[model samples]
Target: MRLNAENIKGMLLRYIVAIVILAALFTLPFWGGRYIVMLVMLMGMYITLGHMWNLLAGYSGLTSLGQQMYIGVGGYTLAVASTNLGLPLVVGLIMGGIVSVIIAVGLSYLLLRMKGMYFAIATWMFAEAMLLIVATVSFLGKGQGLFITEARKLVTAQIYYFSIVLVVITTIVIVVLLRSKLGLGLFAIRDNDSASATSGVPQFKSKLYCMIISSFITGVCGGVFYMSQVWVQPYASFSISWTVAAVFIVVIGGIGTIAGPIVGGIIYVFLSQYLSTLSQIGSLNMVILGVIAVAVILVAPKGIVGTVQEKFGFEILSARRWLGKSLAKVPVAPAPASEAERES
Candidate 1:
């Protein structure tokens, strides 16, 4: 609860490292090739999506397979808002997240009732249903989808910078949340909801809060992605592949840790990109990726970051409890007893 000297040092170190990395990434467009910038932008999008999904599934224990629902909702909302309202792309991006928040609020009641495999199935069903619904709506382009004519005119540099800004915003929000009391409650619930409830954690409220935040961020990512693509189709936007990618990256990187998703995203993107170049494998790249994921799970169930931290005692983004335990381990002299007790 209190920011001790060690905590302050850790905070400063974390911020310094983040600032340095951001400074380097921010200058990529100036000297880096255009293709490299685009590739980085794509990585940023996946990182944001991975972070959002990890917050809910990894930290909150709410494994949703329908995150694409929000992604689709966000993408469609951006397309509509920009086309119909004549809003700026920035405004549409904000609107996309807001619309996702609204949808999450309405969907939480029913979805939250289920648990385990049942919950997963319900989410997938919901996403499919939404895809069908969106496909039938003329305003949403009736499956043909909608394109943001205005966004199409924007250059890749502008889109790449915007993507970076969104990723940074999402990372900051997640880091802040994970350091708060609510974040502790989230981790507690993830470990054991019944125990957490007995210990005064509000299970439903914490889960819902995580869901809303995750959905909003995911929605924004979707909007940015489609804005850059210049088009959105129900089949592609709402494809379950988005969720699969999130789960794969999070699982491979280390679930429930802030650094995990980013590591996972980078690894997944690079591996996928490299595999795609192999002419022999071609369409079988995903199969190879799946094999690797399985191998990682079998060898290191905690994922890359988690395994490294466990083995090396590293704490780049350790939880508060982790820091507390480390601090507790340090030897300290016992305080003198009360004067009356000493006299006695």
Candidate 2:
């Protein structure tokens, strides 16, 4: 695509904004107090989780309601590997992701058989089953959860930096994938799997790729989360709230867009914090959040980022501007000539 001067200016503005925001975030620890830094770290964690969910449900058309399966498993894996087995914390964290990947590979065949609601239901059931199973395991604290040993020595600042690193890694991984041919194929499958397959897009493979990538990232987030807290339990790890939070963030921020999760995570985290401090309404934070989500749905069905892009032509994570090429590049077929014209 040809870039006019106006387009060039817009691209520069987007890049500048992105860079400035990142720079501020990375430098905040130097000036911000412990409480503020902790809040930002929590926001980054939520953003990382939300991004993985968006990749699978928003971009790959796999709406899973059992993502907590990975979360619980990852947390427990780290607990066992690092705390019990006496492995390095880093190795344990890596183990968490590896375990999630292995399980996802096996689950993909079964889960991929069902589509839409069926798939969602299956995933939820799987998570529930896992919760029960983990509850019965004697070594994993028997539902009481396990405390992370190594992380006990780490201070708040150290954990905050770890969260920042995780967010950066997740964001970079997502951006790189979205700019590749595989991401284009995944997008095709998300829009229309049958059409994608007809166009040789490898629909199953693309969906599988999304699942593996999403699960691995989510698992890592889970590990980091429990490590920072120094505790992990089945109920909290496999809670339905994880899935709900991810869905709420993505839906409110713009499900299909890259920057949507970041926007949603920030809004959700801050709003939750503010609402919880109110004596009269603190207990009803979920209710308040639900109402806000409903309002967003009614007025801006495409979500906050989606609506803004539609109205103002602003897209922070637009691949078109970043890659200097249109996102969907399907070729136009040539028109057939009439018989009389062909004779000439």
Best by TM-score: 1
Could you say which candidate leads in lDDT? 1
Task: Provide the TM-score for each candidate, comma-separated.
Answer: 0.90, 0.89
Report the lDDT tens digits of candidate 2 across residue range 1-344.
Answer: 46679978987997899789788888888888988988998998899989999998998889999999999988999989998899988888889998999989999999988899999999999989989999998988887989998989988778787788888899889888987898888778888999999999987788889899988889988998888889999999999889988988999999889889999999989988888787466438878888999999999998999999999987766754342254324434565999998999
Itemize residue pairs with steric clashes in candidate 2.
none
The residue ranges of model 1 lying beyond 4 angstroms of the native Cα positions read 1-15, 279-283, 322-344
- lDDT (10s digit) by residue, model 1, range 1-344: 45679878987987899889999789999989998898889889999999999998898888999999999998998999998889999999989999999988898999888887888999999999999999999888897999888888899989998889988898888889988899989989889989999999988889899988988889999999998999999999999889988998999999888889889998988887888787466448867888998999999999999999889988556666664554566545776999999999
Kindly state the number of residue pairs that clash in model 1: 0
For model 1 the local lDDT of residue 257 reads 83
- Candidate 2 wrongly placed segments (more than 4 Å): 1-15, 279-283, 321-344
